[model samples]
Target: MSVNIMLYKITLVVYIAATILFLIDVLLRRTSLGNYARGTLLIGLLVHTATLATRYAEVGQTPVANLHEALSFFAWMLIGSYLLIDLRYRLDSLGVMVCPLAVIMLLAGGVIFYEVPHQNPMLDSWWFPVHVTLAFAGYAVFTLAFLVGIMYLLQERMLKTKSFSGLYYRLPSLDILDIINYRCLSFGFPLMTMAIITGAVWANQAWGGYWRWDPKETSALVTWFLYAALLHGRLNVGWRGRRAAIVAIIGFIFLIFSLFGVNLMLSDEHSFDAFKSLR
Candidate 1:
């Protein structure tokens, strides 16, 4: 009924249209549909931007205060990152996977309209949005890498097993996938590092200490270390192909645990209150 929800619905409709175009392109081998899908998705992103902006204006602060907000924001980050990567690589095939994932995230978030009574004063600072944006951006980049990794492995398996299929033809080459995975790693590490640094600074301001042994903090650190090791091996030790893809996939799992497992199943400063508590 509200303008924010209405804009969100419009964004979802646009995303679904783009996704349908992409699926048709994949199924019917219509190259023009891919370009149309990209344009449609870009429009959807603009609408999504409006949705978030309206929500922030309505809330008088950052909009990511609950599951509904966080999921929507995460979906936005994911789609934005995918678009950025696709821009560089011209990866039309990836849209098939990413668009559906974005739709699912939006739908799941839409299903839960949990809202808090009052905004947490800790989230009043600019650091809340900055840190969360950087962290979610990092998560988005790694997710793309993981998706590409899966594609790489699947392609490799098909080649080895000599079981050619339509999906194999649709997916990018293993080399391209691996190169993009490395690029994602290179981009995401810095974002994750910045997120941690900003989080520490914010923590110092809010909690009177930079380092807390809280569950979220510890899990983020662990996930960061995992990425660090992966990057180190990649740059210096020359890990590539199956090794890199497999490890990157594992890293994504760790990231999921760090981002969701700690916040949802476990309790901490970043538990999200399941969209509860102004205290």
Candidate 2:
């Protein structure tokens, strides 16, 4: 096995270990285990970074044109974003939610898809990487927001019912989770907007049109509008707490469909095979 493949496997193993540790930390109330989980997560991130860099060196392009690379990159961005948030918020328990997601993404990327390196000239444009990176970064943050929203709903329910368990105590307060959700939306929305604009420009340059109304493009626009409305409601209508969380969760669902379902199931110019044909 090549070093890149080995690194990827190691990263996946580490991520799995980290996820288990995070779960144990949350369920068992082992505060000390949280520190170990964080350290393990950091190691996995470094290894995954190395794996991507190696693949990029070998492929001579951004390593995200294929499903394998795209999923791996998305997982990497998600973990990186979560670490940053944990650093700022000290919400180690959030790892219980995030680490498993990272593991699943990595597994989907590294295991489900056969790893083959091919260069597509259609992705040769400078804008392609920028567009994809910003778009996935936005997705990552929105994912974090969605997880926090779920936690908020659970915590709210526990509070209302007076069910106060260890899980309730371990999770951050509803207010804190809401603030994090809003912040994620604030960061992700502008990135998504820029991604759409860049995507249009790239599309026009490559395909001779700015707006194709392709399924992927249309779904992306719809996802964008969902978040836009969420933000608008938050700022103008003073939507917060449960309402904002619900909207954020709903927006993320649309985002998943835009990213995966449209690309895989729908016929569109944005599909991976279509890019090869364009080349």
Candidate 3:
């Protein structure tokens, strides 16, 4: 096997170890173990970055356009974003939620990456990278927001019922979690918009049309509209607390479906060519 494959395996092992450690840390409420988990996660991220760097060096371009490559990028962005938020908010429990998702994405990469050809042809312009990068980053942020929103709702429900469960004690305050969710969405929505615009431009360049109503395209549009409606409902329709939280959860479900579901069933450019095994 190649050195990159070896490094990739090492990274996956480290990530799985870190995830187990972090889960145990959270279950035991051990701050020291949480710190250990962070250290392990950092090491895993470093190894992951090196793996990607080697792949890019071999390919001689950004690896954001293809389905498997995009999945790998999304996993990396999730780790990076989680670390950033955890640093800012001291939300160690968030890692327990995030690391598993990243691992799944990375494992999925192991399956799909092989089906992808070794030689990635340039798309004739740099806008392809710009568009995909922004979209995946936006999706990453929204996913974080959605997780926080779920946590916020759970914490709030516990408080309302006066039940001090272990999960409630481990999670952050509802106010703080909601603020984090809102802030992430605030940043992510605009990035999603830029992605859409860049995509329209790229589409016009390649396909001679801007709006093709493809499965991935339409699903993304619906996801965007849902989030936009949530924003409007929160601002003007006086929807807050549970209602807003529900909207976020539903929006995220749709987004996930758009991300993986469409790719699995639909035959779009964004769909994975090797997705048969993914099912």
TM-score for each predicted model, relative to the true structure: 0.96, 0.95, 0.91
TM-score-better candidate, 1 vs 3:
1
Whole-model lDDT values for every prediction? 0.88, 0.88, 0.81
On lDDT, who's better, 2 or 3?
A: 2
Please report the TM-score between candidate 2 and the true structure.
0.95
**How many pairs of residues in model 3 come into backbone collision?**
0
Model 1 steric clash pairs: none
lDDT (Cα, 0-100) at 252 in candidate 3:
87
Error of 1 at 9 (Å): 0.6
- Tens digit of lDDT per residue, candidate 2, span 1-279? 888788989999999999899888888888789989999999999999999999887778888877778889999999999999989897877888888998888787765554554566678999999999999999999999999999999899999999887778799988899999999999999999999999999988998898988898888999999999999999999999999889989999999999888876766656765334434
| Candidate order (TM-score) | 1, 2, 3
Off by over 4 Å in 3: 65-67, 112-124, 236-238, 276-279
Please write out the lDDT profile of model 1 over residues 1-279, one tens digit for every residue. 889999999999999999999999987879778889999999999999999998998888787777788888988999999899888887888899999999998998888763532668898998999999999999999999889989899999999999999988788888899999999999999999999999999999998999988888888898899889989999899989988999889989989888877776676778765533423
As a whole number from 0 to 100, the lDDT of residue 53 in candidate 3 is 86
Candidate 1, residue 211: lDDT: 93
RMSD of each: 1.9, 2.4, 2.2
Q: After superposition, how far is residue 241 of candidate 1 from its true place, in Å?
A: 0.8
Candidate 3 local accuracy as lDDT? 0.81
